[model samples]
Target: MQIALTKKLAEAVGVKAAFAQENENPLFSWTANWTKVWDNRRTEDMIVLVNNATRFTVAIYQVKKKDLKNLEVMMKKAISNTLLFMNINPEIVEEYMRLAGDVELVQNRGRQTAAWVSKAGLECSFYVGREYNGIEKMFCDTVGSLINYNHVNITKTRDEGFAPYQEMINALTELTGKPAYKYRAFELSATLNLDVYKAVRRIIVPANLSFERLHNVLQTVFNWKNYHLYDFAIHQGDKYDPAIRVVPNRECLEYDENAVLMEGHTLSEFLPEYKHILYTYDMGDNWEHEIELAQVIEDYDKESPFLVEAIGQTPPEDVGGVGGYVNFREIMLDPRNPEYKEMKEWARFWTPELSDWEKRPRVIRL
Candidate 1:
C-alpha cells in the first residue's frame, strides 16, 4: 500500500519513482524528493508521510508565500530540519526561501476530511481514511491540486511580463546619470588557430549573457562535449593577473587561489573595450581558442545566443591536440594512407554541422 501510494505521488509530480523511499516501522513512513520548475529557476520539494493503524501524518516542504519572520520559531526549526534531512545547506535554503517567502507547513487533525480553500487560494487538506487506497487517492488529489495552483501562479507571474533588458538599461542610466548605450547583440569569433586549416565559429550572443553561458554556447557551436576543464584569460594592460582570470569555482586549479568565478560576470562587463581574450579548454590537450569581439550591435534583437557562422570540424575528443589533429586530418583525407580506414571509422561520429559555415538565427535560445 505504501509503495503504491509512493508511486502515485511520484507520478503526479512528474519525478522518477526511484526517488521515493519507504521505512518499515510501527508506522509506515515514506519520503521523496521532487522538483518544481519555474521560468527562471527550479526549486527543490520534499514530501513525507507517516501512517499507522489509527493515525496518519503528512508534511510538505515547498516554497511558500509567508516570510520566515511571519512563521513561528518552531516552524523555522522545522525548515532547518527539512534542509538537513535533504542534505542541503540550511543557510542557502533559507536564503532562497526568504526570497519566495519561506517553506510552509500544514497540519490537521481528523480520521476523514475533505478538500477546502485557504487564504493562499486552493490548498491540500490531509485526511486519514480507513481504506489505504482511499487515503492514497485523497493524498494524490490534494497534492495534485496544490501543484496545479503553484504552476498557474508562476505562469501568471511570467505572463504579466518583466523586461530584463529595459531594467538593466534603467539601472545603468540611473547609476551613470547619463544616457547609456545599450548593446543588444555581441558579435564574437572563436578560432582554435589563425592557420589556414583551423576550427572557427562566429557567434552572436546577448550582451547580458554570463561567461559561463558563453562557454556553453561555444561548446555547442564547436559540437564538442563539455568533458574537460576550461578558463578565460582576461589580460589587463601588459600584465596577466591570475586574480582576474575567470574559472569554475569547483575543481579550479588557480595559481593565485583568488581567481574570479565565471558564473555571474556578464559578457558586457569585459567586451568591445577588451576586444581580444584567450579561452582554453581541456587541460590535457590544452586546446586554446582566440576569442575576439568583432562588433557590438545596437539594433540586434536581445533574445538569446546563436551560431552565426562556423568553419572546420572540431577534432575528435582525445585526439591529442592540434599537432595530432593535423596528422589525423591529413591521413583521413588520403584514403591510400594505411591508417585511413581505421581513422575514418573512428571519426564516423564527428558532427558535420560543426564544419559548415552559415548564417543561422535562433539556433539556440540560451
Candidate 2:
C-alpha cells in the first residue's frame, strides 16, 4: 500500500513536482531515521514518527491514493535520504540503492547467508541501535508488504570510523559474556500441552541460558524446526495479565509492554522469582508449553545443557494443534485408512525416543 504525500504537505516538504515525476526530488534534507516510524496521534491523512532522543519528527507521510510504484519510488528516496543523513558516502549510497532496486540480481543473491555481497557493506552493523535485518523490517512495515532479500547493501566501511556502531558492538559483546547470569545451572521442566495428552521433557541448562537458547533446546527436545516466533511469559498466578514477556525481537514489543529482549535476558533472572513460566511458540498455531523449575540446581557446574528425560514424539509441524495431532495419529496408525499412504509419506520427522540421554545430550549445547 502506497502512502502519497498530500499537495499541502509535499509543498511544506518543499517538493513541487515529485508526485508526477517518475522519481523523487527532496527539497528538504531528511536527516531523520525513516525506519523509526511511530504512530502516536495519527490522522487519516498523515502518520507521525517520533525520535525520543532528539524529540523531533522523523518522517510524516500524508496519505492519499495507494500505488505500489509510487511506494517503491518513496522507498528509494527514503533509503538515499537516510544514508546521506548518516554521513555515508552519497555516491556509494546511490550505487547501493540502484543495485537494491534490481529485483532479479538481489533474488539471485543470498536471502540469509554469511558470505555477504560486500563486507562492511550489508553489515548487520549498528545504525542508531538497529538490530539484524533492521533496514529490511523498517521498509516492509512502512510499505505494509514483505520486501525481504531485496535489502539495500550498505557498504559503509569500518575505515569510515563508525564510532556509534563500534560502541554498540562493544556493549553487546559485554552482554554476551559467559556465566553472565547469577547461577551455575537450572533444572527446568517443559511440558507441551496437547489438550488430552501432555508431553514433557526435563532438562538441566546453564545459568546464563538465554530465551533464544532455551527456544532451541525446546525445539530440539520437541523436534520443532524453529521456523516461527516464540515468547516466554513469566507470570504469577492463574492470570497471565501483567506477565513479563521475553521475546526474540522488536516485532513482539508491539504486543506487550516493557517486554524483555531474549538475547540478553537469561533464565537466572526470572526462574527464582517466578518458578513457573509459559513458552508460547508459533503465535498463529499457539503452541503453549508450561516451563517450571523441576529442582533448584544453582550449584551444579554444568558447562552444557543435558536432557535427562522425555515423553511423546515431535508433533507434526503445523499439524494444527492437539486435535489436529490426534486426528493425524489416528489416521497414521490405521494401515487400512485411506490417507495412510499420504500420511506416512509426510510424517518423516524424527520421533524422539521416550528416554534417549545418549542421543539428546550430544545435540544440546550451552
Candidate 3:
C-alpha cells in the first residue's frame, strides 16, 4: 500500500525514482526496553520509523524510480498541504481522517536513508498516534467524534477528576448508540489495580486510564520493589495474605456519565488489553528487570517446586543468629547461609536421608 502510494505520488509530481523507503517517526525519544521488539519492526522496508522526537510518528515513502521529478514535486506539495495522495473518495478520507489524522511525510530525501526536510519531501500517508491502526483507528475515530459533538474537552480534567474516564466511556457509548451506564471504569479500576489498568488501557482506554486516576495510582506503586505484593496484586490467584482486604470505592459508579456503569459490564473483557499497555508502558526502559523477576518466580516454581515450597514454609527469624545449634527458623529466614543450601539439597535428597549425627552444624560467620 505504501509503495503504491509513493509511486503514484512520484508520477503525480512528474518525478521518477528506482526505489523507495518507508520510515516510522516515534512520538518520543525514551525507548522502553520491552517495547524494543515492536519498535524494531518499524525498520522494515514497508514501515520506516523515527523514535523519540515529539508527539507524532512520520512514515516516509521512497519512490522506486528517480527520473520523474515532476511527480515528486506534485506529491511533495500534496503531502505538505494535507491533500490525499491516494485517489480514495471523500467518504473514505473522512473516515480515515476521523480514525487516523493528517498525512505526514518528508518533502524530499537528502540521501539514501538520510534525513529529509518535510517541506521538500513527498508525502505518502496520513499521520496518527503509533497506536492508531485499523480497528483502534476506527474506535478512536468513532469515540472521538462523539466527544467532539458532545463538546467534551477530553484534554481537560473535570472538577471531580473523574471526568476523563467518564467522558471517554460516555463518548464511546454514545458512538455505539448505547446508554452511558453500559461500562464500569471505576469498578474495574478499584478491583483490578495495575494489571486491569494495563488491560483496559489497551482495549477501552488505549491511551491511558483517564490520566488523573492512573497518575495517582502509578505515583504510589511505580518504583516499588516489593515483588510479592506486585505479583499477588496484579496476577489473579490465591491471596498472598488472607488478612489483606481492599476497601471499595463506589463513587465512580454513582455517576451516570462514568465508564464503569456502561452497558457491557465485563471486567474479564477489559483486563488483558489494558494490562498489555500497562506492562508495555511501565516496564519502558527497565523492562528487562521486570522480566527477570517474573521469569525467576516462574522457573523456581517449575524446576524446583520442593525448594520453593521449603522457602515458603520457612518461618521468620526472631533475633539474628542468637542461639547455638542454629535455629530452624533462622536457617530458613537467611538466604545466604549454608544451612539454607543444605536444606534445599536435603529436601530433594530422596536417595538417602542425612542422619542427625552426620548433619553438619551451621557455620557461624564472625
Alpha-carbon lDDT, every model: 0.49, 0.50, 0.25
Better of 2 and 3 by lDDT: 2
Score residue 356 of candidate 1 by CA lDDT: 28
Worst 10 residues of 2 by lDDT: 103-112
Candidate 2 lDDT, tens digit per residue, 116-213? 21221122122212322322323221221111112233358545432332232233224343221133677888898776568888888876666777
Model 3 alpha-carbon drift over 4 Å, by segment: 1-45, 49-55, 58-107, 110-332, 335-366
Tell me the tens digit of each residue's lDDT in model 1 across 103-190.
Answer: 2222222222211112111222221111122212121212221122122222356665433223323433343453333236788888
RMSD of each: 16.0, 15.1, 21.4
User: For candidate 2, what is the total of clashing residue pairs?
Assistant: 0
In order of appearance, the predictions have TM-scores of 0.51, 0.49, 0.21
List model 3 lDDT by residue over 172-208, tens digit each. Answer: 3334443332121221221212221221111111111
TM-score preference between candidates 1 and 2, better one: 1
Candidate 1 displacement at residue 274 in angstroms: 1.3
The order by descending lDDT is 2, 1, 3
